[model samples]
Target: MSASAPICLERGDIQGGILRAYGKRGYPRARFLLFHVARAEAGRWFLEQLRPRVTPALDWAEGGESVKPGQMTRPEVTLNLAFTFRGLEALGVPLRTLKGFPEAFADGMAQRDAVLGDDVGPNRIRFWDPVWHGEPGRAGVHVLVMLNALIAAPDVMTARLAKVTAEVVGLAGETAGGVMLLEGHRGADPRWQELAALWGPQPDGRMGPLASEHFGFNDAIGDPVFDGQYPDGAERDKCRGQGAVDGCGNWRPLATGEFILGWPDESQEVAGAPMPLDFSRNGTFFAYRKLHQDLASWDVWIESRALMLKEVWGLASLAEARATLKAKMAGRWEDGVPLVKAPTFADWQAARARMAEMTRAEQTAFLTEFGYASDREGRMCPKTAHIRRANTRDALDPLWDAKDGKGRLGSALNNRRRILRRGLPYGGRDDPDGEHGIVLLAYCADLFRQFEFVQQQWMNHGLDFDAGNDGCPIVGAHREGARFVIASSDPAKPPFVAGGLKPFVTTRGGDYFFQPSMTALRMIGQGLVDPT
Candidate 1:
């Protein structure tokens, strides 16, 4: 491992050990505890301080060094912390959940442009507060801290264990933190209700009922299936290959059973895992979608241009729509490879035959490069296409190392950010008026560097800061009239016909969080945060 990467534990090993420990204690199942961080800086500081305080008894591995460089492995501690609205206040920083920030930022940017009105300045900075200034109570910071420890004792023993764990970590008397007991099974313990009541009304009212159901089992099954598949085949293929696709699809009916919990009135069990809670738990990402499900209409607006879908994708013919969609995404009709680089249809099939010869990374790199260069003329890939805007390596190639003696500037922003998109389609076929849409979930190390920067600076705005033009075609949001437009480099050819988006996916809720080491959780429980 390199010097910069942190040591990580295998998630399976940790989970298995936890389950075994819980089983040995006679508990039917294991329960997870969640914590929320208020501030990013505070979280960083707290984790840094608590690293040493974490005990070996809680440590899953022996002699695993603290996070070192070049380690792609999971952390020795398998703990995930979510940042929340209340936690943000503690950090003294503005808190904008994912849902509020993007919309508010888009509105703010539009307003600034409107005020400027044709005299827009050159790359000026604009600040917008989506939560505090736009939506008041609707937006708040929320982070869910997740930890798995063996529940070895009965009610009385478990209470003693909780107190002992708290005291062992010096968390017995701490005002800065809150503790809420989590029961594995409600039927086995009457105190579960009392503990649930103490947490107060859940901020989103989704957690309580979700907890009442089969806590560990629900998570074990629901986390992977809903977050991994349900929408994107590419993601599903990836998860299945990794063996993360457990038996969750079979649990949907049971999800709404009397024991299962959900939102909008608790009468309906949530169709999928609850938001934020299910995010990234199963080594998958959550795709958030603001679907306009019209129960009255059984019709859906899947493809606005059905004719184009028929013409371009050859769907409605013998080809399946899903297969055609995947083929189009690959830039080829069938046999693999891309039409842009292949030109002749025969070459595409040849490329597909050679798929076994190349590594996965090689294929992705090949596609990325081909798409980047081919879109210049907007003949192969439209200049305004989502894929084109995202991977601008060819465009930035000329400016990569060019600098004005200050810092690295004028180059491809591709290396700076990349997103692993995981989205699911919501609203059943019963809904009409185009109720179906994608819940787009993306994961990246830095929101500013990856997602927000791409959306605001490149995709939505059409300027790369370093590279120029309206950003990505597929996902970028723009104002009416003054749409951020892209034109092909080839003047003789027109840009691929692009359409405006209705901000299809809105950020309803989100928070910045850190998935910490298990040792870090112990420190947190012990109140190891420094006074300084």
Candidate 2:
């Protein structure tokens, strides 16, 4: 394809979740139901009945027509389905077809404990929820049915979800050979796990606007931008901070194959994809992780580290010290301002207010447009910061050739590792050590290359960023004496090393599942798969 050529996607056949994050749109509440398929026939029947209801990537208008992206009102309730390796076998998928899938999907999240840093500490597999741990009596989780709703009221959302559950259960018999809804959630309804975006309070005590996660950081700031994610004209703007960048300072959406199967990837070829393109083309893989936040520990650690930072940096107030420490660790402020753009505590405070006044597009540009080329020494955003490691941008490029005058070539390398981050926060705020966390759902074509590599190399280990074995302070496994070093631009002031880090986030449970396209779903439901 030429540089000026347009990129198109099979919107109608693709799942809506892959193209859009429902939580970021209008769907603020969700319910995830996991099930075990006992009889292949019944499972196929359930899928056949549910296929028509599955939301597609098309931007559907109120009158049932497909409009251009960003022009239509979203659906009131959106539902998507995915299958585990076990689920596919239980559904009678062909052995040859199953063998074609990537090793990471077959091994699943539970099996790759060591690689993901879940081998020990609170994130160990033993500490996972029963639904994921595979309790002796309970059946293995086979199917994941996700329900996202525009409804925001807690009670109303619960009632609607309960009614939907009852309907689905009725369709699939509740007896032997029928689909079984798995349990082990933290709420009253163990059959389904509830999710809601954290919203702030209004003056009248009503929910005001979208708020940050339990850790007080703005969530879902920078998901990947791929070809056909939005309309052609609209995609260019969205790709400013979220897409692949070139050495010449040009930004463009990544190759479609990086996220969806059967398309030209960043390598400009669609080679080595799973066999039988019909079954794999529009489908994608998903990693479902239930991350529990330790609020009490986070609060204590921040307060303890703030005093040390205050003394080291010679800051005026403990508040500035705490904010600076968080920005250094996260690569962004609590309000989603990037340190590269606003390199000081005062700058972040001013940026927050300025961002509030700008249009949505303008705010996105300000937050994500900056890079680490100028601050290669980790002066503004530390090398160990979560965002820096997660998306290196241009830091991994070769030494800049000033004579040639082109930028670093790191975004080309980072493009292949991009994943579409979806899902919302689960549990409530009543308890500090309670069942409150985010259900992180990431979608990609190759789970191993995109999702697993990022988790193992970037988040769990800092070798890629040249920070030794130091892990991400916010989400990584905190071994003994976990610490984060913040560098200063001034030669007079030495680096501020914030130590004594504890486990702030732990894995409750999760799995690797394949979300097939609408075409593939039909074939699976009809038992028409012929691997040859």
Candidate 3:
């Protein structure tokens, strides 16, 4: 499909979380429930009861008009459902249809330790939470229930969740061969996983605004924008830095199939989805990852590294060195200022101050609307930086001006590998050693091509970026003798090498799920999924 081609989606049929990140849309509190379908009939019955409550991608205002950003009235509670491969099998999906899914998804996440680098250190499957460990003599994680809410008080949130949860429990009891809710490792409610925004407490005893993660960096910026994600003019405005960009620095929304199923992708072809058009169309794959952040280790590493880096970077204070080191590692400052835009400590400070006065659009443009064509030498931002590796953003683009032999700024290569990031940080920031990290939900059409490829190739290995085996500085599984190199813009200065890196982010557990469309949900609930 041409870049200028208009793409309209069936918003009512698509699930809400695929197109919109609810945490950003006034739903700060969330609860995730995992279930094992002991019997197919009971599972379908449970799904039937939950079908009416499932939220859609379509956004509406008070009077049912299309909503602009930050203008829609938030729902008291928003619900969505996804199912594992085993979940579908338990629900009596045909063998032919089940076999149509990708191999990586069929094998499950725990079984893909080699590809994901989860076999070693703290990320090993044995160390994972018991919820991930399958029920005795049963296929693990048949169904995933996600509930995002807009409650401010913890008590109110719990009360609301309990009421809805009780209804679900009641439905399960109404039929024989009932489903069972899995016990999560964290939270008071063992039956379900409770997740909330990492908001700090206010001086007046109320919760403050959305806060940073345990790593102390602004999170959830630069999420991918695909065709039909936003309405008309809003699409252009929001796609500025969130979408595909060409050599001319012109931005456009990526093809819908890159994130959603059954649409023409960047390749101009609809991928071969699961059997039956109604089942796969408008549906997407989901990767639910629980990452635990080690604050104590991070603090110790930063405190010790900054002292040495202070002299190497020629910075006045250890604090400045620490912040600069972090920015180089992440390719962005703590306040979400890209290092490509603000390379130095002084520049970062100035940028932060300027961001305070600039409009939201201006701030977003400054932070995200940047390319790596000018910084091929990794001078401004290291080629091995976390953001650089995650989104190459024109760095991998070949020379567009063949006559002039000039490397072009484009996101064509990156577009196919893009995955929509959903979910938010889980635990409190105050207790570093506590169960605090991000509940990362990565949604895409192709799990292997998008989610796994990014995890294995970009984040876990740096060969593509020309940094050899060096992984992402922030989240990579830093094996023995792992080090991060920060290149200097000055010809006279040598690159700063920070060593003794360990795994800062460890995978607690995760799984692959299929988030089907509203139409598919109905078919599954009614047990009318006819593969023929």
Candidate 4:
């Protein structure tokens, strides 16, 4: 039997931070801290100690008890705790329990990304510069703590996180039995006055530091919303903008199971979960990755490519050509306007201004509301556009032609591949260590069919997408014979084929993690598991 909606979701039981879009809350500061447990007993005790602190997915729930005259809840801080397969064993979880986890999770990130073609080369994790020299390289990271807070008050949040880390570290007393801290964002936050003083500042080019992303594009246009969850009806408007709708002629949020584990997916099947439904019920797997973006090379290539396109298409100037090409490559203009909605360069700029003027409520309606159904010819938005490739939405049929591909199954095919991204772009592309990229936190019920499939088939391969061996233009692996084709609106104009692309986004270090339910975590803390 399949669950229809997330009517039964317990805000207190699920970790909200995993699903919550912290960026909207203006929580510009975040830290992804890694840890290695040295002793079983100490690890177990630490797990027990940390249970009360795990941030639940229910933070958005309305109506809270009022604080007393002398009692005030601290301004909320979002944190989630999850562990790797090795961390599970380190906590003395029975081998039986550990053995039942999804094979993708069991294999860990390094080995699995190899199969998914994540551009991992010989030096292994050293492919990423930050992981190459830092403590993260020298040690194995078994636990991850996703720490986040608003940028308005950084010192307070930083101190709170530091204290939380100190308390957990103090439990083991020494490195032999305690956990070793693998600080990923060392002195990264501008508010850490003391640390910034001692280590100097690490300027991030993403918004709040500068104003937009390093590529000069406005990032994270919007995301999917679920039905019956948002009483505010904000999701309904956003879904309309993202062109998300079910087959019922109904516009609604995505099916709950598309993201949260244990819910019936769009097909009404419970995704593969670990032993003990309670443990995996509210939990989901995360594909944590550090992606490095090379801006210097990209800037040069984009400028050169734009000039070439202007004469071929008879465009106004290099600047107009650049905007059109940028929109074509990214599926949206820098202003978060999708190309399918606004095809021309002028339309995008006008829409960008329109978006700025739209009341917050109006902006929601302006999002993903337009699909490629109108432009079946791939003229308005090419089938190979980066955003189109990432989330095919209603355009799945184009990806699978009967001639050499699976017959039209774009709708059903895309339903199973959906994932809720809980990621934030880290460091500026111009950062000294080349650490400028996104810390991707992918949330989904199944790792293999969702994250891996998208990363491999859709993002890296072109056969299924019908582009003939050309992969994603922006972030796909620069593989052998890799290319991207930009279809021209004027049939008289020849198509532009971009070839011999270099690897733009490089994987630093990563891990596969299972973020358990509050109950499952308590069970782990108490060492109460069937493991059978």
lDDT of 4 at 234: 46
Q: After superposition, how far is residue 213 of candidate 2 from its true place, in Å?
A: 0.9
Across 217-249, the per-residue lDDT of candidate 2 in tens digits comes to: 888888878777786646767888888877556
* Local accuracy of candidate 4 as per-residue lDDT tens digits, 1-532: 1233335466567775555666655466666666777877777777777777766654342237665432234335566789888888887777777877889898887776566666433224655444323353465667776666645445665776677555655654554647776543423542211111011233453323322455666665655565433433445445564424443234556666777777767776777666777777777788887666787767887888888888778899898998888888888887667888888887777787788778876875676566666666688788887888778776665443344333433466776787777666776544675546666778777888889998888887787657766777887777655667888877888998766566677676577888888988887878886655
How far is each candidate from the true structure, as Cα RMSD in Å? Answer: 17.1, 2.4, 2.8, 5.4
Between candidates 1 and 2, the TM-score winner: 2
Q: In model 2, state the lDDT of residue 368.
A: 83
* Model 3 per-residue lDDT tens digits across residues 32-131: 8888898898899899989998888877575567677534444678889999988899999888888888898888888888888898788888777788
Model 3's alpha-carbon lDDT is 0.83
The global Cα lDDT (0 to 1) of model 1 is: 0.31
TM-score of 2: 0.94
Off by over 4 Å in 4: 1-6, 60-76, 119-124, 129-138, 153-165, 168-176, 183-212, 227-238, 241-249, 397-410
Error of model 2, residue 430, in angstroms: 2.0
**Model 3 CA deviation exceeding 4 Å by range:** 1-3, 62-74, 135-139, 201-207, 400-411, 431-433
lDDT of 4: 0.67
Worst 10 residues of 1 by lDDT: 213-222
The clash tally of candidate 4 reads: 14
Number of backbone-clashing residue pairs for each candidate, in the order shown = 42, 0, 0, 14
> Which candidate has the top score in TM-score?
2
Candidate 2: misplaced stretches above 4 Å? 1-3, 62-74, 202-206, 209-211, 401-404
Candidate 4 is scored at a TM of: 0.85
